[model samples]
Target chain A: MAAQTKPVLHGYFRSSCSWRVRIAFALKGIEFEQVPVNLIKDGGQQLTEQYKALNPMQQVPAVEIDGITLSQSLAVIQYIDETRPGPRLLPGDPKARAQVRMISDLIASGVQPLQNLYVLQKIGAEKLQWAQHFIDRGFQALEPILKQTSGKYCVGDEISMADICLVPQVYNAERFKVDLRQYPTIKRLNKTLLEIEAFKVSHPSQQPDTPADLRA
Target chain B: MAAQTKPVLHGYFRSSCSWRVRIAFALKGIEFEQVPVNLIKDGGQQLTEQYKALNPMQQVPAVEIDGITLSQSLAVIQYIDETRPGPRLLPGDPKARAQVRMISDLIASGVQPLQNLYVLQKIGAEKLQWAQHFIDRGFQALEPILKQTSGKYCVGDEISMADICLVPQVYNAERFKVDLRQYPTIKRLNKTLLEIEAFKVSHPSQQPDTPADLRA
Candidate 1:
């Protein structure tokens, strides 16, 4: 794995899940070749036969490196962290690593999956309402943990994988017009997170992989 | 922390989530005292003043140990694993830890959040449809990963946190009328998981925390 040898990220530009992985890679400052898989414009480029071969479940953000294709955003990021040493995303201690993993799970398993874009797309007639409903619930569930656990960052000042999960979920919240004022801790964390160059360069607007028309 | 000492678990008997923690405690052969924070019949006692003091969010499965109170199921479980060394719930390697966390997430974040009792209670006339829809989507998301990684257990031979997340989500699926026949891997995993005495004792039906009405 040479520094110049970037991994191929099979993902879409607007997907919030994809944004999470993008932020992790940027935070770690790893170079990756973007293999854009448009989720909507082409009826989901992720549904193609070739993509299915890469991920049998047909999901986005599958990464290919060293001839090994890996699925799942968190797993891919952890693999990158293990293979390459940089800014540590997890605590060196086992208990702290578990804490980081727990915080990451609160977003990954708790908040993010509920208001997922596909779920938004699947709910047709009252799509907007259902999407907003889940978004509100996810924000509500996540707020408590954010209040108690965060200190400058998600789990203290040093950035960990949990921060990576939080940034994209917060971005999704803003995208859907979910007022995050109620969650003061979240707002503060997001504010500070936005100040970091790692989150800035990986912001959805800055990605070169996104379609020009979709780039707001 | 004596093995015979009574550890208090703040949970509702009717709460499937509480059952997960309870099962974990019992499976480890750790004796714990049960404190009922009735979530439903008592106007959600979990949301009462006492519980709010324990958990700002007022969710179940909060554990009080060594004069410290911790919320979030994964955090509580991790605390248990760190403080009490019994059968190791996690692997020793970082790569393996990542995989276990990823699989646990597939169940915890992907499956559990959607069918969470509170979420279902909030759903309207289209309840059954949404429940079944989400359960189907969760299983669809998990199948590929399960097919790829599962051995005698979710990862290889030993039971990890992944098993904890899986059993509860599968139980919730059946509660929502999601047919298990569609997911052969999950069905097989559950079949094997149920055989373990720990899982059997942890079964919601067998828990003191499970309310009479909800008991199978």
Candidate 2:
């Protein structure tokens, strides 16, 4: 995908939530300028007064699109899928959409929120363990559901919003060193999703702002 | 609403998430049988093998609707609004729906997950403070957005899914003793939402399984 000035995305390279939006944009073939918000350097640029004015939550990737700045990764993904031209991220059938959303919400609210950086920070020295615990629990629940719904993608053969949500979360789970071998379905899906061009381009290492030492 | 056998909702009386669905059901005037899943007694009925078979996540409310059991509160709510006969829970315009979803996500992923009973149990002694901290942070972000979009509702007088997510969260906040005085917008919205029949009927205290002494 070529870079253009359609939307400005403020994000950190390693943030799973930010990566979710990046993957969506890549899949949609939408050109966006990446404005790196260094989450580590000088204590997170997202916390700055300027960024706070952009997003009161002080989270990333807050995107400037459709003449407004939007926050929350899932909402941003839905907005992009709705307003922009894309292979539809959500399924057309309401029941299929519900199934897709079920997986998406499983990750968004059930998995990612409990194990994100902010929650890890709050968990203190046991952050890694805390992350692994939640990821394992979420994956255990997700594996059975995915087994029921998945084909080549999370829901049937199509790459829907569920896949968009799943890949990044699996990235974070691996980062936390949560063993995926136990979750065969998730492991298989993650491996398959990582091979996709959209997922490849949106990888944290591939981000323009990814540090040299962290580059994969 | 007349009692009918369309959906069976397995939910705890006090769960904010379950309350969100209850409010949606009430607003949509869909009659669902409530099968109480006691989260406290017998070490949480949701953890039992039978309940886990129904919903591997072991969370309430696990709803049996449209011939399949659905878990995850947001997904269930979306499914209800989408598949059933009801007033629309989301807005018509894409941008409007995005705004509504943004607020809903802020509360769902940002506020509720961090402060839910499971996490509170994990937080141990400092659970109350942790709950208050997150609720305050979320309400701070929410107050401004609500200020922009709200007029008798979370988004321009129509009770979108954001309002469904909000009313129950405010209930949880008050339970945690989080001061709402600082968030006048949230406080006012909560007050107004409470007066509505749907929100009133869905209050935790009014649920069929709510303990008699706890009944309001």
Candidate 3:
């Protein structure tokens, strides 16, 4: 609760939403402690009453900062951006900011949720097909929009929340065997973002809870 | 494109995402033109190349405002809130703003997308059961958070984007037969929000494209 207290992140190593918050913190040069809530452990640790108390949604990447806990990766990212002094995660211009939000929401709300671990578990035997179908659909729409919006990043040369959202999604796409060649703009943008130090440090493969075999 | 030009909204009458935009515009008292893109007509009008050009995502509720076309309801609502002079759609306080964003994302990304027509169509014969399951899961999480955050609205006394996201999802919950008694806080907030003119005018049944039998 004190101003000098380090923030705590309750997250899973490979959860895209959790990765988003990690990238935001790294980009802002803010140090935070990690409390990994392994999503797949013991029939999902996030479903336990203890973790649910921190985030009633029982989702990973619930952050305790500035004396309060916040969930939803986009919310956590924006909060860190607003309260921290760093390179802006959202652009200064209103239109560009809107573009960044549009891209972020398109992936966060429209695409990723369809293929998430929880949803796939419910999806049963056809999980791979379901994940591939939705990822492909999302990337198909994303490609043209990125072509219009990208300069050096997802919106006119700035590393933004959109760029933060892009990499994890592309990682998911590759995991599901979605061909990147079909979405050249998204592919190029994800590649460009991955080389950034903040993204590299915050990557799923680099996380504290990343299984030893999966660590970078 | 000009400041004086009326914005054009391309949307479906029943889409909760589109309804969220309608509520925000009405709350801000912005006058705009509506172009109905019937989702079920002609095997889905939103699938047309013409509509896809406006929104690469092929979703309803794409808005042409200030010369740029934006898809994604939350992005469009935030754009209007930032640019227009009206009651704030987002609270000014940092923590409160994050709470609003959290609730909005919970419903928008977590609950609604899973039950959307596209997803439900894929769900086949078990569509009702699938919708009920997710709505119950979302409302279960939301009820407790709303209990913690609500004063007279989802975050406080003022109507925020969280309120905009809540009503439509509640409507969907009712349509899917989720019991409202289980979520006293959400039910109370939705009841209070519905009495306001902005929400009433923006209800799905009152839309310009609402079919004769369906109109309120």
Model 3 CA deviation exceeding 4 Å by range: A1-3, B1-3
Could you give candidate 1's per-residue lDDT for residues A36-109 as a string of tens digits?
Answer: 88777678778888887776556687788655676678777777787676898876765556557666766776
lDDT accuracy of residue A37 in candidate 1 = 82
Interface RMSD for candidate 2 relative to the native interface:
1.0
> Model 2, range A72-141, lDDT digits (tens) per residue?
9889999999888869999898878988988999899999989877778888999989999999999999
Give the per-residue lDDT digits (tens) of candidate 3, residues B1-216: 445888899998899999999999999999999999999989999999999999988988899999899999999999999999989999999999999999999998999999999999999999999999999999999998999999999998999999999999999998998888988899999999999999999999998999999988
DockQ, each predicted model: 0.37, 0.78, 0.90
lDDT of 1 at A180: 83
- The residue-level lDDT of candidate 3 at B203 comes to 96
List, residue by residue over B173-214, the lDDT tens digit for candidate 1: 887889888799999998899889888877877667666786
Candidate 1 residue pairs in backbone clash: A109-B109, B13-B209, B13-B210
Candidate 1 ranges with C-alpha deviation above 4 Å: A1-5, A65-69, A92-99, A125-148, A213-216, B1-7, B212-216
Give the winner by TM-score: 3
Give TM per candidate. Answer: 0.86, 0.97, 0.98
**Residue-by-residue lDDT tens digits, candidate 3, A107-155:** 9999999999999999999999999999999889889999999999999
